[model samples]
Target: MENSSRDYSHINGWGIDADPKNDPTYPMKKRTNEEHRGYSWQRPTQQAETVEVLHSNERPNLTAVFGTTVPPSGLSGMLRRYAFKHTENEYAHWLPLLLADRINVVEGIIEDFKNGKVPNIFAEKGMKADLQHDRAGLIKKAVIGGLLIGGVVAFMAGKNSNKSRKLDY
Candidate 1:
């Protein structure tokens, strides 16, 4: 062992294994012919691209393992496709992807209703858990949501009233 100018003796367990005889793996320090070799087996076969797999613009080819469950199809899918056109580094790529995710949630809810299944949005959103653990946060969100909806309704009503007045003139 070479002596260093900077002392590491302050550190706990420092130089504990300075003596090779004290080393745990010293007994099993046998070198093998294949010890320095890379992976022995070839890469597992790449999953077949049966569905429309959205890949980053940077990647030349699809990855070995890629998801195929949900292929792009609807409006959200179109936004996602547009998003993928731009580089991942730009907001143009990310913002549309974020918007698409929100849109997909709404789409899912609509699809549930269309299938005659009334989705339990509260349970699905973990509101019960929020109520138990984060009551204040849940209340704050509800208040803000109510205020936003109220403001929109009021604005629409005012716009309708203004149109009605214009018709009377």
Candidate 2:
């Protein structure tokens, strides 16, 4: 085996100690088994195809990730929390397929809650003031309506009394 450091090539200001071409001594900086490895930025053809297959499988593995127990509030909180945590895990390629499937389901639940189909705990917290204002407006309208009706009756009664007095006189 030839030593790569033995052959020295000089370029402008840089000292090239190792052979740029074929190195007989140290073959292509072999990756150590303990060296941390990760999924390539672009997945391999087989891995991409495998991910596609896993996505289409539809086994409802979200139940495994999110668990069966509903959160303290309801399904919305449980799903939202799971989505956030799942997103972080997905970045690490831990649950890309499962998380991708679940993200939409959880987001749909959140949207339904927004559309008033489901009770959204997040909205409920902020809507207390709005609900109170609506109730107060309804009460005010009822009170104003009652007062207007009472005033009309009083005016009619007064007119009747004046007419009766003139006729009697």
TM-score of each: 0.76, 0.22
The most accurate candidate by lDDT is 1
> Candidate 1 regions off by >4 Å?
1-41
lDDT of each: 0.92, 0.52
> What TM-score quantifies how close candidate 1 is to the native fold?
0.76
Report the C-alpha lDDT of model 1 over 112-154, residue by residue, as the tens digit: 9999999998999999999999999999999999999999999
Alpha-carbon error at 23 in model 2, in Å?
Answer: 55
Clashes of each: 0, 0
lDDT by residue (1-169, candidate 2, tens digit) is 8857653335553453355444544543564643367535753333212111112122433222222332323453444444454434354334443554566566667868888898565464454554566767656766898999999999999999999999997
> For candidate 2, what is the TM-score?
0.22
Clash pairs for candidate 2: none
Error of 1 at 148 (Å): 0.7
